[model samples]
Target: MVVRRCLVLLVATAAHVGCTYDFDAFMPSGAIDSDLVDDTSSGDAVADDAAAPLDSAIEDVIADANVEASDDVSVETSADTSADTAADTSADASADGSADTGGATDTGLVDTATPDVPVSCPDPEGKALGTHCYFPLAADNWDKAKAGCEARGAHLVTITSAAEEIHVESIRTGKDRWLGLRRPAGSPIGEGSFAWITTESVTFKKWGGGQPSGAGECAVLRAGNDWADLGCKSPRDPICERD
Candidate 1:
């Protein structure tokens, strides 16, 4: 006759766990030809040996379960790391692409920090280019000229395109005029790194050959054609612009 039995072993992780083990035993029945009482002990010993294998199998199952749990944890950790990396990448992309990608020039930069003002030209006498209008006035130093433009709800022009440059040249009746471009103070004034205060980008530039030779701190449209670096205090009429 044979009998089968199942045993269960419970394991625990920091979180949770369980496992199952089965043991089978064979027993002999009916009278034997040689009935040796001493042999009975041998039979019992053989049963113990068989049970040893069952114990070993249970241990093996538990070890395998532990390894599987550890592997699951490791996989989850790796997945979390990947998700974090992806999120960081998305944030960076949004930071850089938001401006140029969206039609709001410098939407990702300085312009975004300020209010989104709708550009409107109440006076049509001044030439309109892009989103702003330009007005040519008499001569004055860079600071005074900027102030004057401000008095009229405008600022010095910031040229960012070739078309705008051409328009300025076409209508410029007098000498060169001051533009809003400026070099960093305490830094080389005219070596050509400039920014547009009204907007966040320099879309166009036309500097004269050897002009700005690191000469002065302010920028001007010379002959309304090309740009040159000049002293900030130099007397020159500004091409006022407003949106």
Candidate 2:
């Protein structure tokens, strides 16, 4: 017993009909209503579900990008720091080299190689006389005696004055000693042609009569405290002197 609405039409003229209708009578059971269209909660729910996943995915992508950027920044920062540290080390090495150069320059202050000597001479003889010192010792020959005296920082005695001759004679302990008067084998006559092996000549002579032959001979102290010529190969004591 359902209630219903209907539309009925009666013909009043041959070409027209009067009509009455109830539009609600055509509605089906459970049909959609305009109020139901306004109620869109299920569509809102579906839209929210889709949007939530999309926002979550976008946030995850942003987080991954941030992580990659952070790693890149960290790597770049490490490279920059390593470069700075290497630069500092190079600067330190340069400073050390400069300091070494400074030290080398400072080392020049203490390079003394030679020292000064005194004017006085060293001799175990009695005393120094006339800017010279004398030493008396045994020697082999003219050359060997000269070598020995040179080893003592001296030369064979060269007597230029009578007092020097007497001083040399006074020191003679044994046999005759060699003097520094000498000349080449083939030489000119006169004392001017001879050279004193130990001193500069000032033209003084104390020869014994016809002594000091100018024929390739060396001089020696004779018995009379006078000079005499002798062969150079003969061994004799030497009176060494320093001037």
Candidate 3:
């Protein structure tokens, strides 16, 4: 019994030593596995950090390309606009040139159609008619004077100014000449307010002394600047006319 008890005690001690060694081995293995897991996680974090910069660089490159492309499009659009403006300017210039040419042609046609009329004048001494000058006709009635002047394509001289009256008087013959003087019938002046027979306004007036008496509306200018009021039907010398 003593020998059996000693052997049992020795076996129990050996078994306890074996259990402690196994526990120690298992603890070291678990620590190594945990360290390995932590190292792998740290490596993965570093790799992710390294790839972040690359992603940012790629994004920057893409952004630069997009900006460059947009700039290129803007430049192209500006060039096209410039070209269109130049074309429009050219068209306007062409239209202006065509208008100028057309205007020149029209002026040339107008110049060709209407010829200039020439002016002719006789001696400066006599009164100038339309285009001719003439002396006084023979003494005759007012009607006869009108007829005479009409025949020569002229009318009796209408005296406007004293200077013109003097001029006519200087050119008259010895006989009295009827002038273009008339007044409205039954007027307040009783024919004293005389006007030119041509119906033109009297811008000037010269009456002889002691002439244009009451009821003496009709009048005539003779040589020596002599003016006499007479009836419309009175016979007298008529001045020739010209044009």
Model 3 Cα lDDT, one tens digit per residue, 1-243:
443333233334434344323433534544434444455445435445555665677689999999999999999999999999999999998788779897343444434576535434343334554344656676467877887877767788777667666667767766667887877777765333778778878787665666676445567775656777777677776765464
Candidate 3 structure lDDT: 0.64
Those runs of model 2 whose alpha carbons end farther than 4 Å from true positions after fitting are 1-126, 189-192, 214-216
The lDDT of each candidate is 0.69, 0.70, 0.64
Clashes of 1: 2
Please state the error at residue 223 of candidate 3 in Å: 1.6
Q: Residue-wise lDDT of candidate 1 within 1-243, one digit each (tens)? A: 112211111111111222322212322543222333344446445545555666777789999999999999999999999999999999888877776567345534544477656556555447777667777766589989889888888888877677777877765666888888887777854444677767568767688998677778788888747888888888898888876
Error of model 2, residue 111, in angstroms: 30
Which 10 successive residues of model 2 have the least lDDT summed? 5-14
After superposing candidate 1, which stretches have Cα over 4 Å from the reference?
1-125, 189-192
